[model samples]
Target: MARPTVFLIQIFAIFGFLHLGFGAPISLENPLLRQELDKVGELPGQNFVVNFTHYSGYVTVNEDSGRALFYWFFEAVEDSSDKPLVLWLNGGPGCSSIAFGEAIEIGPLLINADGKSLRWNPYSWNEVANVLFLDSPVGVGFSYSNTSSDLMNNGDKRTAEDSLVFLLKWLERFPQFKGRDFYITGESYGGHYIPQLSQAIVRNNLLSKEKSINLKGYMVGNALFDDHYDHVGVFEFLWSTGLISDQTFKQLNQVCANQSFVHPSESCDEVLEMVDKEIGNIDPYSIFTPPCSDLSSNRLRSRMHRIGRVGERYDPCTEKHAVAYFNLPEVQQALHVDPKYAPSKWDTCSDFVNLNWKDSAGSVLDIYRELIQAGLRIWVFSGDTDSILPITSTRYSIDALNLPVIGHWRAWYDNDQVGGWIQEYEGLNLVSVRGAGHEVPLHKPKQALQLIKAFLAGNALPALQLHSDT
Candidate 1:
């Protein structure tokens, strides 16, 4: 059993910005801060030694609604200032980027299997760039709203608007990053979040050149590109992969063909029930991997299973650990989380936020088209094992874009092994992480790092072997 680390640290004025002993200079003059800033002195069950700095705090996005979005910042392991800043968001329309993106996936630390301690991850993206993980929209993770109504009225428009506000105010707190090269990345529904947020950033930069975010481009993985094609691709993947029966696939195509995957009709639901039977006990997130022990209940037999479970190498159970550690009073106190604002318990994804999510758009394809036209680096990646949002789904949407293939498809390598496959379109890139699941980083960290490195550098994925130098 792992125990929380107990330590004494300097406390700045309550909720006012407090430096976490990072050598970074602070002006403290930024009026955007209302309460004292919160800093994580140490996390509970973190026994591994680390040299990089981490901070946890809230930025008030809506003062009247008391809506504050929580964020955790990790400076790069090397010369921190020179590195580009990357903002990561996890999609649920309501998931905690901190809990999923940071703690369990590509962040510097990994929660131990005991669900009580921490370990360092060699593949943390922060090794190459400064990373910020945010739990956005009110009522998700440590992010909260004083007004109850705020929780029930969330959609892509509001989320994008509030997130843009959070970014502006956050920059005010850490002014050093004001003109730094900035990039946004996310996964799953993040396919929706990243584009919408990027659109806002682009518009803001155009409106006022003086106070513009140095927006570069964005990448989304295992994302929901378009509802119609996602529906089409999922059924195609299921049938083609032999995960579903011929009859079941045919019926699903006919019954649920023209419905929203997020909220399908009764007929669609029934067809999906047949899909459930065909999928049987397989993990929907990573069809070939064994699901965590907690997922074997008969109650989940025929329901849509979210892509969250532990693998043999990476503990899918890390979510449970994060909830326990973050909810600890001592840990919360050290992070400057005011008890009143914190949830009764932290969750990886919020049902309240998802339930109230008002999806107004049918497809973000138009947004992709706009961003591609804006000359921003756009990359879309998919984990081959994700059944819910399979690679086939991604291909369908990409094909719809009708972009000419600039770089023909080729297998990319990592550590002299086939990492995945990649193909560059005229303005975009589509990648598939071979043998990886819905959460690519969680299952294949090294390859995920390779993918990001290539994306950030605007270079093609490394070829397996350069042809003979004749």
Candidate 2:
């Protein structure tokens, strides 16, 4: 394929996958639009030196519905062409990965305290892999739909289908990434997105005469998986950590047992609401971290509440900075956002999408089983300080798999200090990030970087030293 240096695309994702019929491409390419439109140079109020390549734009997944997913891609600091491609999504079932993943977690820079300025992130994930941040499922961040109806009717299956389609179209835009090793990564609700999308990719590859995505494996941290196990573990951690009284814990267990994360029983909701009042103004997602504000007492914003955007629920104030930065006309223009298509105001998460989330799998454990059997590199990590999707819950969820142990459980080290604990299973691995919260990278970026590097290399976390100053 010739490099059409003169053209950039507003990708209308015509191609389909995973139970959707494939459509022929339409001749709607705009040759006058240069790829420079997508290349992000210095951003508005950027104070740090720009050193590497990054681009932000949209990939239209449904032309008929005018639905497009926004993405931000960053090349590795060095030897970018050789690094594996890693796609990062943030869960919520409706959250903006740009807001959480790129703005604060692992993107090249952090939105500064001033809300409009930027500073360097020494621990950005792009240092290791060619990172891609996607605002998926339409109506997320800069991603939008001309058809308002599309926003209300989104679910796991369509999200996966649209995402796979987005990937297919996006690969066309940057043909250089064609066969590079790719991995899907996210957390919270991504317990469903990652596995389901991986299933779509695997099945799609099996169907393609020539293989498409060079999918190696994936990793998820502080993820949501089993409904029963996850729900049970959240309460147990609260009880063990003394966040809830023993009597309250017993009451919760009695009332909330068998309650689905998405649809709790009336008794369960009443008990949870009571417990929310019990926890007070502290962030449930990161128990030890001082919450930036007290906006969530009315309704616990954590997944413990009806909302699924657990990862960023605790981060009310921090996200405001991102929202301010991304919403700026200059910032959006710099990122090539078409104002006509973008929302009047940029938001970090969408309540409408969450409220209308049509389908959510109760457990991705079966998909996990299938992927593990397919020999995908699967690892699940947890932040020990998180009460929402606590490490205990992740352990219980993974334990339900009942796989044989390959590597014994032990402590892992980073910089002569205990970073976390780890255990390797026959087909999957589990890790617990010490002293970290729900958003592992936001709280412990150095450790998160080490974890990502290990995951990309398929190596275990660094072993503890024989003799250490403990």
Candidate 3:
């Protein structure tokens, strides 16, 4: 299935819910959402349902076609006195925020190993600021659209626009949040997601005062910011780590430095070819490699079976147990998804193919440049172990930006132990989490949280300085 088609399926599902009052009251009782929240334990001094009641659902973005568009999920705790509103999106160009919400970071709950129960994350982001996790672009998670055509081609532009609409309406729904400090945050492709959406918010704010949205800053973890540098860095990392032989490394370096490096398509081809030739000889667990054709097929089948088995009970984008637990009939009825599709799987990263997107605007670098020029704060972070988009690539990509350095490179320490390295350039902050792979939060939660907290506070995290070893 094409990217657009996959998106359409999500839109159709969302619209079906909208027809049912956008699953409003029922969503409060949604089995999946409620179960996850319940497991996390109730707020410090408040009833569980009372805290959940702060969340409201309605069509945030309405197309000219009159189809009601809705985004569902919980709201961040706010004093209604003073606090910043932070909007969060998870990548996949198709993943839902709920994955990040319930499992990692901060929501009200955490899914257990069994995937059926939840527990509260005492250190959830809400402890500091109000956070909003959104299922976006119509077909992701609980957010949906009535018209298939309304589904974006899954490009950066459309995703940004749709998110903007959701943000505007979300603000309207909670008028108390207006004039409050606001920010955008996400992971993975969200590196691109948050910036694009922030730029759009800035543009709309500049055009009409009444329609303006206040966007403070943005943050991304293990983000895919620049394709050119990111790709080259991946190979360089492989070479440095001895994943590729001296001969293969030399060949790759020559072509990358001279030819393919400047061209994304050529570079991608070269990298894939090199990976194909050497992957079998290398340790799969040690270095991150793209999905080989054979492995890709197996992974695809597994994903499909997982998705098919879950049906509509829950999203099947994450892992298997996650699907079963979140899809229980009790969970579905509470989440407000049709009970018929109840007990279905929930995919945080499903391989729904019908909706592959092909019309994304230029490379991520192009979008990053646009956002920076538009005066939005951009942050790109990486987990060093991630072979898919390793720290080496992220470093190389940022180096190519040629932006003025606001802060020199420094080591990030944890409990007095060296944790990672970070640098600040103009309005953009770049950092690498030591000992972490693709998922920074999952692998290094404390470090990840500390870095984020400092970023949000608009202060520099402690810099790593060279240590003298005698």
Candidate 4:
């Protein structure tokens, strides 16, 4: 069933955008979105000097509603001006990219245990690309909207539209990045953000030559592409990993049939409760890692509800550092965060936005088809140990596309050791990271760096040999 969506039309009207029927983003006024004004002079607890410059500020997406999306842009570590620009998003549809993308995963700095200092990420993606991390929608991180209704109304369409508008305005602030090779990368729900935004860029690029965005390609890891496939993958991962019994597995398939993603049935919830009790406190996001034993059910429930089971953090209490660090007045001041905003404290994920997400396209596979056909460099990867959105789910979703096998399954290398397995499809490549969980870089930073290098260079992951099965 198609969504009764007039969101694009509504947004077009809001921005006075000419409806090209493909969500084209034209330059619009952003009174606060200016160049150099948003630059970060120094952080609250930084001890080391750096060559690259970075900025943190908001780009007003909707003037009528006062919706501004926050962003943290980091120039490349070396040859800063020459590198490609990579926009990173971390998805909960409501998660903070500044928290996950910038602080925890790919960003240059990691919050210290003291929650006041920072350490450099040796394998930060900025080594090769200028990375931009955004806190999208109105309610996530420092991004906010004055209208209360905006908080309750956000869904996929609005999020994508706002993000495209953000990029349009953002490029104006950093015109040096205007025609650079651009790529978007993220994990989990970013699965939706990257493709949808890519489609918008591709379609809008057709309207004008001077304003076109130079989008080269994009990638996602352990992403949520399709709900049906995801649900199937979850139950199967649970059973295969011995987290649930055989009988319970059968019950999950039966009682949970046709129930997937955010829309779960009553019977499915009941089944999940049983599975939850069986799984206990172990982190479902990474079965091998220890769970964050400190967080309350209130703060942790967002992920728990993602796959019908309780999940803890990949890094035990790592977000506490980010939460503590980002919420400080000094840090906020340094980042150019506007003081007046709803929900005063900073959090990694927004439960309000998650609960009220009004509309979500169930699958991005079709969007992938369109982008793939358009010759966009597309790649999907999985952190295999992530039972939350497992490798199995990625596999099932990719298989559903029925794309031609470009290369047989092969072992990809990092430092001559088997980092993971990879298989290439007609336009998409799927790679799995061994011993990695939902946050691939956090668990396997070196390998993650290698993966990014391959994807960005339009080169394949270094391989041992093709598998005999193909």
After superposition, candidate 3 runs with Cα above 4 Å error: 1-60, 63-81, 149-152, 210-212, 246-277, 280-318, 338-345, 353-355, 463-470
The models' CA-based lDDT, in order, is 0.80, 0.81, 0.57, 0.81
lDDT: which is higher, 3 or 4?
4
lDDT per residue as tens, model 1, 411-444: 8888578889999999999999999988899989
Q: Answer with 1 or 3, whichever has the higher lDDT.
A: 1
Candidate 3 residue-wise lDDT, 1-470, digit = tens: 22223234335445442122233523323333322232222322222343533342335476664333333344555563465777777766566666654455556565655667666666566655776677765556555555556554455667787778777765655666777778777776676677778778877887876534677778877666565565567668777876678777666655553332212345535545665566453222123423222223333112211211111112222334455555565655445454332213556553441145434433466666777877776677777766555677677767777889977788878767877888889868888888765656655667867776787788777654456779
**Pairing residues by index, what is the TM-score of model 1?**
0.90
User: Model 3: how far is 186 from its true place, Å?
Assistant: 1.0
Q: Determine the C-alpha RMSD for candidate 1 after optimal superposition of all C-alphas.
A: 5.0
Q: TM-scores of all models?
A: 0.90, 0.90, 0.73, 0.89
Query: Could you tell me how far off, in angstroms, the CA of residue 202 lies in candidate 1 after the best superposition?
Result: 0.2
Clashes of each: 9, 0, 46, 0
Can you give the lDDT of residue 274 in candidate 1? Answer: 74
In model 4, state the lDDT of residue 339.
78
Question: Looking at model 2, how many pairs of residues clash?
Answer: 0
